[model samples]
Target: MNENLQSSIEFSHESGFDPFMESEFHDSLKKKNPDIVINLISSGLHKSSEKYAEIFADIGSSFINATHTSIAINESFIKTFKDKKLIV
Candidate 1:
């Protein structure tokens, strides 16, 4: 299964960067120009509401920022690939 999946798809790995930094994030996005982006970061997953609030004053905002940035960065590319979906 892993071999089949690998043969059918191309995957790239990047790490050691903070998504909150718009410039760095955007630069990576522009470089990759991926057709799909799956955001697996769950902010405040097991924490209480108060704790979550205290921990992240603006939780989930980064996802939104990433999504918008992806759209903006891939505007022209998306126009070409009309069926492509941006799942950030």
Candidate 2:
């Protein structure tokens, strides 16, 4: 997944946001000014996933999904990126 995410970031950085990208989930977010963003991160525990999460955090977006069975994004990671929002 890290490799995939690295590749994805490379592509996104090179080509701009993909209208068809899965994170388009943020579309609704842009509408309501969501304060929390729940997403599946357990499946993304790999190095690249962590890297991608860091990038997302830099942009003020936290990812939480069904995979986040604990109902919380990692506090340590969250603290590093203050603006990013999280949801359960």
RMSD of 2: 8.4
State how far residue 60 of model 2 sits from its true place (Å): 1.1
lDDT assessment of candidate 1: 0.34
* C-alpha lDDT values of all predictions: 0.34, 0.48
Tens-place lDDT per residue, model 1, 33-83, is 444433323443423322222222222211222222243344543343333
| Best by the lDDT measure | 2
Per-candidate Cα RMSD to the true structure, in Å, reads: 13.3, 8.4
List where candidate 2 sits over 4 angstroms from the true fold. Answer: 1-45, 65-73, 81-88
* Superposed Cα deviation of residue 27, candidate 2 (Å): 17
For candidate 2, list the clashing residue pairs, or say none: 37-86, 37-87, 38-64, 39-63, 39-64, 39-65, 40-64, 40-65
Q: Per-residue lDDT for 22 in model 2?
A: 49
